[model samples]
Target: MNRLKNCGVAVALLLLSGLTLQAQDSTALNQSEKTIKKYKPFDANLQLRSLYIWRGFKVSDAPISDVDLHYKSKDGSFQAGFWGGASLNGNYKEFDYYVSYTKKGFTVSVWDINNFSDFPNANLFNYNNGSTSHFIDAGIAYKFDFKLPLTLSWNTIVAGRDTYVKANGKRANAYSNYVQVDQVLWQDEENSSLHVFVGGGFAFGREKNFYGDHPNIVNSGLTYNKDLVLFKYHLPVAATAMFSPEHKTGTLQLVANIF
Candidate 1:
């Protein structure tokens, strides 16, 4: 009888030990999972502007609101986003989607640009050649690591509705291209900065192009940006003076961050 009692106590202790060991293993596994886990990062922005000006052209004369949502990699080397803008008077609307990758000081990106105002009845998903209203643009930029802070970029329309009529009355892809340079004149830690930029447009062929009949400077501008704290919230504001020498037009624009 005493032997049987000893055997029962030994079995109970063995089961208890086994359960404790299992619990400890589970806790270690949980900690290991937490250590290796990663979370995705995303950002959203909204802005209100006095006008919708892009490159060197006036997209909208009325007030416009812009919004963007983006997902950025943890290392900040990759990003994908959607950006949209709409005018208050309902005359202008634009939607664009892009994906970009950056390494060191060089960046490459592709953008799908859609101007709904130009083709109000156009189907959004129609990607057929010569029938779609979308424009696919590929761009590359390099930021010089200099004290003066300068960046240069070039972009070209590779596909979609970027077309023009040739001398033979045949529609041909224009392959419109724009090259730009930006330099920062001054900046402070408080996010106040002044910048000057210039851009020109040309086409692969010498015929009538999307920008103009001849290659000319299309965008030149000065922009001043400052961040203000209002009600304990960071509000960024900017003023831009833009001129289009090709069109002989100019505009002054104000922008404010809504959130």
Candidate 2:
């Protein structure tokens, strides 16, 4: 229940922030660094955000609760730590964490998930089964520059979860390719930016991709940001609105940073 409590606290805080503040979002919220400067060898951007997709928030099927904590360090290295709410139909559980690294168009990482709070209704519908499944993957990406502003990357599951979903779950694994891109527009508000994102992901299930191909999932949003000094930390604030074609809905997200 500790994980649940923490997730609840984080959600409450994020929702409360919406009430106390009114701002609009961008690049840092997603994967775009916003050409504030050029991508330098030793440049790193600290990120933090809470995403509330209109459909994700309202989904009676699968609610979306996500907290994004990522750090892109010098040498083009990146690491992201994430925690999300319960998944209704996926093998994911109360906690799913990942650590990834990238360098010069190449990337690799190890990911693991834990499901301690097995819901009573939890079945093949949604549950990783209070088990820990780990996997390692590697991939490469190309960054489009001075062109259409796009990024192309290829990845392989490389390995499967050591365990399977609950008895009501599928015995297969998840695998897919990811393609995403972002464009930065000079919006002039606290070094804010407008971004365009498009991604295609395919996962192989025990049965037949259990879910589906979900080939085209595109999102577009705006982000306003400013770095401020707060008790010895550089705080970045962002507000965003985006839409995905699959769910036929939109999302309004707000996130802040302290570095």
Candidate 3:
């Protein structure tokens, strides 16, 4: 009878331990569910810059203000955005829209770029081939998973105003191309980083076109980026010193994000 009583006690203790383990597991699962992060689909921001420079050319010496609006997929593999910039002196204006898809470390995108500096009277909605100011570009980029971050990209103008005059006195698509490489020299846990980049432009056609003649090293630069906290607000800022070997020119720019 004592042996049977001890066996009963052992069985009750095992049952109690199993119940306790199951309850603990249930609580852990609930805590994990609560800790999962939620995705934000929409974002918008404005940037102010001391100068407007692109590729190797200085577009505007005046202060520039840029606005960006973007929508991203929940998984972050797809994005679409509109980016526009204007000079304070109102001499230069650009509106661009792009859609991109990313997988692993590769990204491909299409951009429609419109500049009103050349054709101030052009209609924004007009897609008429010869009369429109829109330039269509396609690009691909790959980021390497290395000890130091590295990225390479290629962009080409495929259609619209990026054209040249042929020998026969006819306009032809120039198909301007630009290739770039960027490396992150240093980055900290706080997201402050320094980057160095170089870019070159090529003309696919025989005639002169945008980005000038073929095979020109256009943009080479170093950028320092950091975030500052002031008055209980976080602000992001960058300072860039860029040089164009082809153009034999250099410029400095400062940018701030006002959110």
Cα lDDT computed for each candidate against the true fold: 0.90, 0.50, 0.90
Q: Tell me the tens digit of each residue's lDDT in model 3 across 116-216.
A: 77787989988655688899999999999876789999999999888766779887787889899999999998769999999998886453557765578
Q: Cα deviation in Å at residue 75, candidate 1?
A: 0.7
lDDT of 1 by residue, 1-259 (tens): 9999999999999999999999999999999998776555888999999998888889899999999999999898999999999999999988899999999999999999988787878898976657787889999999998876899999998888888767798877889999999999999999999999999999864745567667889999999999989898989999999999998999999999987
Deviation of model 2 at 50, angstroms: 5.0
How high a TM-score does candidate 1 get?
Answer: 0.82
Best-first order by lDDT? 1, 3, 2
Give lDDT: candidate 1, residue 75: 92
Tens-digit per-residue lDDT, 183-236, candidate 2: 655455455555555544445444322112255454445545566668877676
Alpha carbon RMSD to native, model 1: 9.0
Model 2 global lDDT (CA atoms, 0 to 1): 0.50
> Which segments of candidate 2 are over 4 A away from where they belong?
1-97, 113-139, 145-150, 154-170, 187-191, 203-214, 218-225, 228-233
Name the best candidate (by TM-score). Answer: 3
Off by over 4 Å in 3: 1-36, 205-207
Task: Quote each prediction's TM-score.
Answer: 0.82, 0.48, 0.83
